[model samples]
Target: MEKPKEKPIIELKNVLKKYDDKTVLQNVNLVINKGEFVTLLGPSGSGKTTILRLIGGFEWTTRGEILFNGLDIKDLSPHMRDVSTIFQDYALFPHLSVENNIKYGLRLKRINLPRESIKPSIYKKQKNLQKKWAKEAKDAMKKLDKIQAEYEKELTKKKLPKNKLVKIQQWLDDSDFKYASWEVWPSLMNEKFEKKYLTRKITNDEMDKIVKDVIKLVNLEGHEKKSIDQLSGGQKQRVALARSIVIEPSLLLLDEPLSALDAKIREQMQQFLSDIQKKLGITFIFVTHDREEALRLSDKIAIMRDGVIEQYGTPKEIYDYPVNKWIANFIGDSNIFEGKIIDNDEEIISILDQKIKYWSKYKFGQNEVVDVLIRPEDIEIKKSKGLIKGIVETIVYQGSYYMIEVKHKQYKILVESASEFEIGQKVYLDWTITSMHLMTQEKEKNKNKDTVSLNLKLNKEEISNE
Candidate 1:
């Protein structure tokens, strides 16, 4: 049985953004499903952030639609849409404590009530009654706490009987005073406190629970009272996250939120962000230039370049089978070989007079030129006889593995091996035929258009195969 498809929470349909004569994004089409962590990944000036701003309502699209829950939200203001944004700088209130910062958005938020159902006279009466009840409830809670503490102390000193203790516990449990302010005060005051306010604003007690939950979610429980300036970089980031998520937005836009942190903090925050997203189960559209970070944190990655999404897929798909040579190099280290199809029947390609067999979903005509990519880790280097012989030009230690650059004929190939190899030593290189990936070549003229079209086509094929 197949699982039902998840609904898309946000979609960009041929979205284009322009500032004066400079075009920021052109023909951008993307879909972010609910509860998926999608990353807009690219180098600087690739318009990744521009797409984020457009979806966030910080910027408007020049010639396309931005959809939220399948409806066009191009005209909706940032506050009007159920979306939140966290910037790189954390955008926290320096003077405000973490709790206050998280509460800020909820305080400004309003819930609509039916005016016909709530009369102004009745509303005013309930407003006063609510305040009276709130005070009474707080006083009752304090009395209950004091009484319970005194009883507990007496019991600890063996001055109170066990029968008395049991009766007291039962009485306390049965009373409304046992409930927290958020859980009990509202009902005691008015069954519908929201209707009491003409402006339909959240009550202080309601906002308190929301802020508290979000603080705990981001792991900033003990630091809620600390000012923004007192927080470390990661803590400040959590505060920013809590503030944005407190309003319960349908989508969260994070623009390089961890870029400002140092290496150790950045990695810690990445894990923290991933955990929080999973716990909340909200759509997160993150933007970052760090390829490794994107691979680690994203369920889907949109690789943007020159104001266009070059490819959009899972990290493994983009890394193992990029659409073009540019993406292959940009995504990760690869040994690329320019070749031509020698025999279409056998799927054979000629690379530097060496015939290599490869497999690809896309077919090519005989004599058609193509590019073959094999990752360094995919290639195995042996000191004995193999398919091809080469001289080890350079060897660099990369913690777990050694990166050996082997010179085969006039071409240089990289191999990742756990065994050590000496420079200028004779070595042989080999890999399974399935490890070789064929990619489309980029054309200088109409490059972006071609890349986008090919990417769409390739993605369609990939989906069909799946």
Candidate 2:
């Protein structure tokens, strides 16, 4: 058996950042592996920048240690660390040429090595390596073609027809005979693929390969000659990313890098950022206040409020399993009920007024008061055949979805669906027991957690009763 790998390139241990009376980050812990793109997602004022600053040495941590290559970097200054930060403003010197701007960080360090001295060697080596890989990939493709043609002929000529075997062979060929993968595949099958898989170590060449690929991946392929002002906001952002990644920092910190671009540009940039992260295998800690952006781009998301991280997990986890009522409503649209846990049966739970039954591996005692959260998308709205009935308070026609509000007894349940409904019309609202999400916590009366629904009907009568 092969041995396990070493620790990550950068690790933040019990990190905390404070400003005057307020604490920005509270015992933050994260590990950024070599060539791993891990995005840090949260809203504004969530200390997302503070974590970046701590890693970049722009700000000092009040408590924890920042480690680089498994050594303490708490005392290292920004220049000392190999990390380079790309700020939202581009922060490029207007007077300097594009070439000079790229080399600015190196210049500030005042390394004994001259630009002329290193440029030829570095670029020559990179060009030669690219040529070598291009030839190898070309050769591999030729070999694969010959092998595949031979197999295809053999398969066609065989008297014993193998339907299952044919399909399996097709699968192997489709997979490039394990030569390349959708991402990465088994090490044993491809020697070139496994060349970088050393135990407890990550090669600098591996980092360089990703860095070079990201430059192309982000579509900044020919902008090496363009000046800062000459490029548009989207182009500038891509260059900023190229600058940040050239050194192959263990942690890549992005602070709302796409906010300045137009909607179309933003979408395009988002795809580039997402794709580059995957291809480079870099840990990206992306900070954004946009809910849609966070939902679309993040692998794991941390929804934050004020200076606190309200919830943290994979995008699906946070969207599905919110810790509390605030979090449930924050990340997405949720229909919440401020009620008590009445029955608390072995598997199911009953909320006040609404008896919702769900299978739970977790056990709770009877008579436990809790808040029940149901996502707007989870609740189904039909014109007929629903248990809880109400008059449609409102009907909103969104391009792709519908918002529905149904008044039931004392509460108004909001439902989101692809179906359309009319306002002031009567409708029925119901949900499967499994659709109910319960939160065993106290509720805040004034805070209305129900987001917009497709069709809804509510007025004085519904408000007075509650």
Off by over 4 Å in 2: 1-10, 31-37, 76-80, 97-99, 103-215, 442-466
lDDT of each: 0.85, 0.67
* Residues 1-466, model 2: lDDT tens digits: 9734734877888877788977878887776666544456666666777777877777777877888766566534353466766777877766665444554443332213334545465556555665666666667767776777766667666474588567748755565423442112221223222232211233455444544465575676666566787888888787777767655555677877888889999999888888877776676777777777888898767666655566767778777777788788777878888755556654445543656566544565677666677888888788888867788887676778988887777787788879778887778777777677767684533224453221233555567778
Per-residue lDDT over 1-466 for candidate 1, one digit per residue giving the tens place of the 0 to 100 score = 9956889999899988899998889899998899999999988999987898888877788887878876567534455478999998878899999999988878667766668867788778877887888788778777877887776676677566779878877876655325443335544346445534544777888778778888878888899889999989888988898888888787899999999899999999999889989888879999999999999999999999989999999999999989999889998999999989999889889975788787999998889988889999999999897889999999999999999999988999999999998999999988888889988677764646888889999999999999
* CA lDDT for candidate 1: 0.85
Model 2 TM-score, 2 decimals: 0.67
lDDT of 1 at 457: 100
Each candidate structure's TM-score, on Cα atoms with residue i matched to residue i, is 0.76, 0.67
Worst 10 residues of 2 by lDDT: 182-191
- Please name the candidate that would achieve the greatest TM-score relative to the true structure: 1
